[model samples]
Each structure stands twice: as structure tokens, then as C-alpha cells.
Target: MTTSTHEKRPNILLITVDQMRYDCLSLLGHPVIETPNLDELARTGVRFDHAYSATPTCVPARAAIFTGQKQTSHGRVGYQDRVPWNYDKTLPGELAKSGYHTQCVGKMHVYPARSLLGFHNVILHDGYLHHNRNKHSVPMQEHFNEVDDYLPWLRAQVPGADLLDLGLDCNASTVARPWALPEHLHPTNWTVSQSIDFLRRRDPSKPFFLWMSFVRPHSPLDPPQAYFDLYKDADFPDPVIGDWAMKEDPQGSGLNPVTSKGLVPKRRLRNAMAAYYALITHIDHQIGRFLQVLEEYGERNNTIIMFTSDHGELMGDHHLFRKTLPYEGSTHIPFIVNDPGDCLGLDKGNVVSEIIELRDIMPSLLEAASTEIPDTVEGNSIWDLARTNGKALERPWREYLHGEHAQGMDSTQWITDGWEKYIWYSQTGEEQFFNLAEDPGELHNLMDSPQAQERIHYWRSVLIQELEGREEGYVQDGRLVVGRKPVNILAHLRSNE
Candidate 1:
């Protein structure tokens, strides 16, 4: 086969699904949710089982991805609004610089509401963001409605269609229900529709970088009625309960009784899980259609498709509702890299167990384009390890990745080695450790166990050193301080370094 330059410099398709759990995909071995398209992609690609969202929330996690920096360097350790995402170099910007036509077709929680952030074109749809609608958002501009693209298109479709009509909160992770609108109007379908249209009108001369970011399986938990009915009657396993969860379990989902956390009826919990699973399956189907459109355009065989998520969903685990926790359910995310044989080829069907963070995405994709990764990137390209041609390669990066999310008393910090995970409740200074190899569900808390004493001490010492430069008083005089607020960003820490 004669190699063509187009085959060598393949088009990049980066697909990100919102709030998807690592284990929920059928490819990843979840028993209930059938995500055939995603599973097929995994079968043909390298699946990184240990990939994570370091900060484990929408905004902060994406900052790590788009900038190739950890939460600390990116100055978004946890979720915050209008934090000025003024990165000097961004993933899309860098790709655009390298002659790739970059386009984003879904959720981009970038501040300023309309900031391009380097993408040449962005068909934005960020579900429902409360912060951007605030008066203080996009500071100095001062208008309340930041004007999102989706709602207007939706209103155009239904004349007076309102996504919030059925009282759905996009941030509510513990919620689930059937979509009141037609399936065609669903956000998942709309995103794919826009991507298909972009494909039909895309400039064919350049190798494109497309981000089909799906904002589903996140919330409103609203799947189409047909998708919702697929699992509404199914049985489900009990939520994973840790020994210490009883004290911290939430009573309800925010203020709504219709959806909530804590000890709820098993039937109601199953229904929520069913809807969540159904949303994923729905997205997976749309992905299949998008791939078909790519095939029609003769782009599928030559494109390098990378699928991941911003963070993950807690989905009733430990009586927890959403992300912003250090639990595996919240931080662990799906990462699949489908490098076509004609493209920048990598090992096929490789299940890499090495700990990989979301920060690695920028460098990896740049490497895929045969472009230079900026020296400022904190993560090295995984492509180096992956190009072993069908063999699993365990190249050394960080021995463990540090992650944290701010939630007042529920604020957390943790480090994981894919084998073992150590979590610290930053506020209370309480700790929990799990041998993730044996307990993937995180049901056991080994904090008090004598067997884990040495490991606990080791990780604790690491955290102490890690927090030394924090301005939040999390550490005081070389000791981990209890009851201190876990501040999201230490803006001055960079200058001190």
C-alpha cells in the first residue's frame, strides 16, 4: 500500500462525553449499560483503564486537558467561575497553529462565554451553566444572559421550548428523568447533528481537529422517552457503601425531593441509574451515526478518534450524588485512543493500566498530529508508550497522580497508583485508603486498618509536602491542618517557585 501524506497526517476527532463514569461503558465491563459504539471503539483502540480527571469537575478538569497542565499550575484546583482561562497556549490553539483546522461542537466551559480560546470555530452547547448567567460572569461585560448557542436553537425548533420546563437541574447528579421533548431535539442528538453538518461543510484541504463534546450522562439525566424506557424496569446492584459513609451521606439532591442522595428507596435509586445508563447508550448511538457521516465523507478510515470525558459521575456511590470527590466513581474516567493503522498508528486493543491524567491529552493529541508539544505542557505524550505496535507498554511518568476538588467539608485530596488509592478529606483531616486492585467499588475504608498503616503514613507525608505552599492554611508549620478551608488556587505559588 502506497502511503499518502493525508494518511500520515490524519484528521483528529476528539470526542468527550460529559460526566461519564469509567466503569459504566459496556466496553469497560459494566453489566447493565450497553454502549456498543463506544465498546467497538475500545475494541479497536487502546483503552487507558487508569485515566483520571485530576480535579474531577467540569471546569477544572477541562482546564487540565486543554492546557496540558495539572490543576495547580492551571490555577483551577477546583471549580470556580470567571477564573480567567487566559492560558498562553491552548490545545486547540496549538493545533490551529500547526495548520490544523480546529473546531469544537459541544460543551466547552471556557470563561467569557464567547472566548474562542484558540478554536477557529466552536458550535458551543454547555447544557445549563449557572455561573455564566450571573452578573459577575465575564466581568465588566455585566449582562446577565451570556447568550448560549443551544437554547436559542432549541427555542427556534420548538418556538417556546425551554430545557428547564420540567424543572431539571443540569448540575444535579442524583437526578434522572425522561426527556419531555422529541428525541431529535435532545442535546446529545443536536451535538451530533451539528458535527455532521460541519463535516459536510468542512474545508477538505486541511487536516481538521474536531471535538464532538457530548453533554449528557451528566444531568438533567434526561434521556429520550424511548431510551429511558429501555432500563426503567431493570434491576440494579446496591450502591457501594463504605464503612464511614453513614456519617457523611447526603439527605437529598440539593433541594429537590424528586431526586436526591443518602438512604433512598432501592427502586428509586435503580430508576436513576437506569436513566443515566440509558443516556450513555443514547450518546453512544449518536456517536455511531456521527462515525457513519464521517464514513460517507471518506474520513473515518483516516481519522484518529480519541474519546474521553471531563470528569465522572458518583451516581449514588457511598450515598454521594456527583463529582468533586476523590472516589474512583468521581475521578476515574474513560480514555480511548483509536489510532487508525493508516494514521499515527498505536498498539491496538491495549488496555494500559498505568496512571494517566486528563492533562496528558493535549500533548498526546499534538504528538498525533506530528506537531511540537509546547514545553509548558506538564504531561508527556502517551503516544510514545502506545506506539509499541500492539503490545502494552508501561512507560514511567508520575508514579501516582494527585487530585482534589473543593466542597467545603467534603473537600478532598487523593493520590492513586491504579493499584491503591489514598484519599484525605481536607477539611476534617480524615483519611480513607483503598486497594483499588481488589476493591474497585471502594466499599472498604482501610484508614483504621493496621495492615495499611505504613502506606497511610507514606501518602500522608506526601500530602503534607504537597500542601506546604498552599495559602489556604491546609498546612501550618509543616503539619496538615484540620478544619481549614481547601482553597482552589494558590495564585502566588507559581511565582514563589
Candidate 2:
């Protein structure tokens, strides 16, 4: 492929889904979920097989996306609400500064509920955030009715309609149901519908940066009746349970509806899988709708579309349900970039195996727009890797990535170099090592294997060095410390602005 030149900067469309697993796409050989639209999009550009969210939670992962910084730079290592998003630079904000009309159509998941974080305007719906929904916060703009643009829009479509009308808990892993409302009223459809409206009304004089973020395949497990029917009878594969997991929670899914780790009953798990797969297919079709609009509007070829997720839902992998785990089911996410106009001449249909993280999105997109990347941004642009099919790079690439979450189950610190991964529990000092090249499902623990001891020590030292000099005292005298209390936001980020 050769670079193609254009008189004007290409429009950027970033499509983000919540808690979508890397293995869920049929393009990547997923047996159940069908994502024809996403697969088609991938064929137009490049797909990354090893993309990850360092923190693997909504708040922290999104912080990395917006700020283009790692957990250390952004000061958010875990899921927390109400922390002000005061980053000096953001992806959408930077694009707006560079003369693009930027708008976000769905979930921001930021503090203050209404913080724009650099987009010129945002049509927000941050799912069911408990922090903003609490009674004390209701009087403020944090309330859903005040800050969620979707709520008002939904109400206008159908009087007295509420997202919670079905009474499903937002985080319930075992829950599954068909949406009670009309299919068009679903949040997935609304995101694309509103995005098309934005494209229609956008200022034609300048290029646009539209973020069509979807808040589905996350929870409530409620797909429209039609989508649910598509998968209700399909047989689904059982969750991969590591031998280590059974030792920890022998009771399994029997523990609770939302238990993070357990052997959930087959019936409930199957129902949840059906609903989850249905939600994904629905989103895929909605994306198809938006792409069609972009094409009909004569902007499809000139628009660059990138799709990814903040993190992956475990969905019973290793008996885990939600995110915040260092396992592949939680951290690994889908990342596909489609520059339909060949703006950067990216290798279409290329699947890059190099490890990339959420923070890389900012720098990559900014580079795509020919905008200056902020000096504070820690992630490197993935353009060269994508263009060269991960074989060559104009600049040096990271040999390994260090990731962490302040808390999940005793907090986690992990490192990976695409082919292998190492995880350490900060509080308990327990460790897990997986050769991803051999065991992508992570069904085996190599920590106790004598042959893996030396390699494990090398990875452990790397993590120790990465955590060295942190305020939390994660490392001392070149060794990882145990029992160090973790903070959701680091001291530097807490004091920053």
C-alpha cells in the first residue's frame, strides 16, 4: 500500500463499546457472535490481535483513552467515580483544537457527569452509574435525567420510559432478559441514530471528529426481543475455568448473581451468553446503519473509523464475570482501524500481533490527523506497526507493557509482550504466568512449574522495576512488597489540577 494524499483532513469516527471481549468477534474466529459489520470494517484497514486496556475498568480505562497516558501518568489505576477529569490534553479536545468539529454521542464515564473532556459537545449516556444516581447527587448535574442526553430523548419517544424499567441490576452477571422497549429505543440504536444526526448537522467547513461510543454488551444483558430470539436456542460453549480458579472458589456461580468468581449454573450462564451475544449483534447492525449513513452522505471513503472497547467482560472465564482482572478475558480487547480513503495507507486486512493499549489510541488518532501529540502522553502511535504489518517500525516500539489496577481482587500488576503474560497480586504477593502463544485461554498456571521459574523471575523483576519509587511502596530494595495499600487514583493525579 502507498500513502494517499488529500486536500483536507479525513473525518474521524471512533466507535467504542463497553466490556467487549477480544474473542467475541467472528472475524477473529469467534464461533457464536456474528459481527459482519465489524469484520467488514476490519477488512478496510487493520485489526490488532493483542490490544489491551491497562487498567481494565470503565473509569481508568477511559481516562487512558482520553488522556493518552498510562495509569501512572493519568493517576487512575482502578475503577472510581467522582474524580475530576482535569487532564490538560484529551483526544477529542486535541482534535477540536486542531480545527475539527468534535462530538461524542455516547458514554463519557467521567466525573462531574457532564465533563466534556475536550469534545466541542457531547451527547452523553454513561450507562447506570451509581455514583451519579444516588439521592445526594441527584440534585446536581450528576443525575441521569440532567446529564444523560439519551434519557430525555427516550422519554420524548415514549412517555415515562426508564432504562431501569426492567429492574435488572446494571452489574448483574447472571441476569439476562429481552429488552421490554422497542428495538429502536435501545441505547445501541440511539448512539448510532444520534451520530447520524450529528453528521447531518455538522459544520461542512471543517473536518469532524465524531465519537460514536456504545454502552452495551456490558450489563443488564438486555437485548431487544428480536436479537434475543436469534441466540436464545443456540448452544454456547462453557466458560474456561483454570484449575487455580476452582481451588479458590469451589462453590462457583452458585455463590451469587454477581459473583466475580464462581462456577455459575449452566442454565443462567447460557441465558446471559445469549443476551450478551444478542447485544453484540445488535451493536454490529447499528454500526452498519451508521456506516451506511456515512456512505450515503458521501463521507464514508473520507472517514477514518476505529473500533475498540474500554475492557473485556470475563463472562465466566476462569470463573470471573466482570472486568478488572489481569486475565485475557478481562484485559484483552478488540482494536480495529479502518481508513477507508487510504489516508495513511494502512495495511488493510492486516492483523498486527504487537501489544498495544488504550493509551495508544490518542497518539495514533492524533498522528492520523497530523496533529501534535502532547509531551505528557506516554503511548506511542501504532501507525508504523499497522502500516508494516508489525514487522518494521519507523520508531522503536515498546518491548513490553506494564499494566495495573489498584483494586479488583487484591489489586493486580501485570506485564505482557504479546506472546506471554505475567501477573502479580500486589497485596498477597501471589503470581501467575501464562504463555499466551500456547494457552490463549489461560487455562493453565505456570507459576508452580519449575521449568517456568526462571522466566517468571525475569518478568517479576520487570514489574518490580516498573512499580519502583511509587508512593504506594509497591517495590522495596528491588523486590515487590506485599500488603501495600492501593489507591484508586495516585497521589500525583490526585494533586494534578
Candidate 3:
């Protein structure tokens, strides 16, 4: 171990990938999709098999990651349309105050891409995609433009490339063409390049906290020609419920509701899956490059590297395309933490099966970095589990993991207690309960089962208690709002003007 003049504090490198499922990595033993770098990281670090996103969307899940609180507590529930700007303290802000140099690259999904929140330096690469907007000045929009720009180049590289027409909106007539290019030209590669540059130039005296968030394997399923070609002959597996062909969950379906469509055709599904997997592999390559730089800078051993996703992609799983559902395919994500033993004494290469939420990341980082965790933060640190090689010091440390999704009238609440998961929908008084241990695929609904009646009742009671505790009162016209804070002065001014 390298000795330091002062007590050595671990540097923090938190990597959040967009729309990544838990089983993508080779380490997770997936038959398809090669993620060698992530697999290696898992071997050197601790992987949490049961880790899940508190809010299975972009903004709220990100907010939960930055602040050790649930989405309801922080109030950032959905995309750009209805995200709450005013929220509680953030982890980066806390770390900055504690003498850590903070930086963020790639996507944060905050309203304004450059909203620092707490980082000293930020390179905003992607943000929310505004459906109604025309201008493409924002990072996310610009990134989409970049994809458009690269299409011509991709088409020229391939002999009969007609895949460029398969753009954003779902079109049954469209088909993807094979790509032939290097992974380094991908947007994720560029994001990793920016992060590596920042890491190389960052001052070593103060511990650094960098957020490398990559927007890949998300949508538009666009990978370079070479990556697409790599999976040309591979047999793409059908969705778990392919035989059923039943679209039970309306919101989770791959088809766009406004357009009134169904699942993409079999050929299109194969091409999309291939492109998606290629994007993931490309992302893994970028991650490997970033990790190499960290090692070269002698920061690997003294750094706490966390690899996770804001949420997961359905990726045609259960015939679902995007997130914002209460399913294993939508909510479950890979959470790997490489806490080098020199500083944190964390057991290397252990896979923890504890049911932890993304909100716990902030507190866990604080604990690992020897910094103070805020009292207002709702998540508890899993430092003990890490240090003790996945062994729980206390039984039943957490009874259940909670999640909320409130976008317009499409609101949902779910609680998972390892063995079972319960979901309650607000729009329609629909409830779904599943015994995950027995039925991993969640094909059977246990809410009406006589044997599961008591279990469902107990979980429903817990959900009610949690939601009641988080109820926010609103005012009509000029009446006083009981639980709502007054709108910020700047926001009020902007609105009035």
C-alpha cells in the first residue's frame, strides 16, 4: 500500500449508464452481449445482484442517486415535462463542502444541462429530449443531431445501408441495416474521453469526485456499423413472454400509445436487440478506457468506483421498450462498487444479494470516502456489507424497497420485499402482487390468491403508510398550501414575466 503524508481518502468515480439492464454483462452470465470490462470490474469489486432503482425513470432516479432520498422526498418524478427544480441537498454539494473537487460529464438530465447542483466543473453532454421543441441547442438534442450527422457516414460505409430511415418514431415499415465502424466514434466514447481528460488534469491534493454518466443503449438503438455487423448471424432471443403475445401493461408496451401501435415485427426486434447489445458493448469499451486511465494515474487503488444505471431498459423484455414500470426487467439494474481495500477495507469480488436502492449510493459514497453523511438523507449506508464481504451485520436491515412513478395521471407505487413485489396504480385502482422467489418471470399475479392475501395486505399497509407520510398538500387559488413550499423567487419571476 502506498503511504500518504496525510490520511488517504478514496477518490470517487461514479459512472451511471442510461437504460442498462442488470443482465447485460458477461459477468452476470448472459449468453449474449459481451461486457468484458464490466465483468472484470465485477471480479475486482462487489456486485449487488438485487440492487434496484428507487424511481425507474431518468430524472427522479438521478435525483435519488445525487441525494440520499426517495423520488417523492426529492420531488423529481419524471422527464422534462414535470420535474421539480427545487429539491433537497445533493451528494456532490455535500462532498464539495467537505473539500472534494467535484466534476460531472455526460448526462445529468437536470432541467438546465449546466445546473451545477454541486459540481465545481461540468461538461453537460445530454439532457431531456423535448418532444414539442424545435431547437436543438440543448445537449440531449445536440446528441441526437450528432447521430443524424453520423448516419450519412454510416450509410457510405455500408454497401446497402437503408437503416438511416429507422429514426425516432415507431414505423412498422422501417428496417435496420448493418453498421461497420469502430466503437470509439460512439457518443459514449466521446463522453468517456471528456471524463478521462478531466481526471488527468484534476488536482490531486484535494480528493476528486467525478460523475461519468453515459447516455447509451437508451433509444434510437444506433450503434456503429462494425458493432451491428458483429451480431448479424446471432440468434436474438425472443421476449420472455413471447408465446403469450399479451400486452398486459399498457404503459410498458413497446408501441407508442399516441400512435396506437403494437410490438415491432420479429425482424425489427432482432435488429433492434442487436443494435442495443452493440451499444452496450460499445459503452463497456468506453468504460474500460476510463478505468485504464484511472489505473495509469495511480487512482484505482485509492478510488471508489461505482458502476450503475439511472434505470434499466426493457429492451423488448416483456414486450416493453422503455422504463417507468414495476417489473424486474424495468426496475432491476447492475450496481457494482469497486472500493479498493487500501482505504475502505471492502471485500473484493463479492456479490451481495441485499435489496438496496439507488438512493443508498450517496450515503455509501460518503461512508467510503470518510466524509460526513447528511442527517436529512433518507438512505442508510451499506458500508458494513461492503467491508464484511457481503455479510449482513443485522438481519432484516431493511424490510422493503419502495419506488414511485408520477407523470401526469400515470402514477404508480411499488414495494419489493426480496421474496415478493407489490405494485399499486393510482390512475386505475389496480394492484399486482408477485412471488418473485417462486415465479421469477412474474407471469402469475398473486394479489388475489388466498395464501398471499395476508402478505399483500401487509405490503399494501406499508405502501399506504409511506405514501401518507409523503403526501404534499396543494393550495387552490390564494389559500395557504399546508405541505408545499412557496415557489422559488426566480421561478415565480420567470412565470410572471
- Which candidate ranks first by lDDT, i.e. highest? 2
Best by TM-score: 2
Q: How do the residues 1-497 of candidate 1 rate in per-residue lDDT, one tens digit apiece? A: 12355456888999999889898887755667888988888888888888899898888988888899987788887777665667888999998998778899988887766778999998888877776555654454523334467877888888877767867787655556789988898999999999999888876777889999988888887889999898887767677877767644364433343333466555656777888989999999999999988998888877999899888888778777778888888889998988655466567887877788989999988988888989889987887556663245454467788888887888888888788888888888788999888888888989889999999888888888777867777788878778886676656433432
Model 1 / residue 20 / CA error / Å: 0.6
lDDT of 3 by residue, 86-165 (tens): 54478898888877889988887665444688889877655225531335444453343342323344456654543324
Per-residue lDDT for 106-167 in model 2, tens only? 99999777888888899998898887678774566667788888989999999998878988
User: In model 3, what is the error at residue 7, expressed in angstroms?
Assistant: 6.3
Better of 2 and 3 by lDDT: 2
- Candidates 1 and 2: which is better by TM-score? 2
Measured with C-alpha atoms, the lDDT of residue 53 in candidate 2 is: 91
> Residue 62 in model 1: shift from native, Å?
0.8
TM-score of predicted model 2? 0.96
User: Of the candidates numbered 1 and 3, which has the greater TM-score value?
Assistant: 1
TM-score comparison, 2 vs 3, better candidate: 2
Cα shift from native, residue 249, model 1 (Å): 6.8
Off by over 4 Å in 3: 1-7, 82-84, 131-133, 136-166, 169-183, 242-261, 389-396, 408-410, 469-497
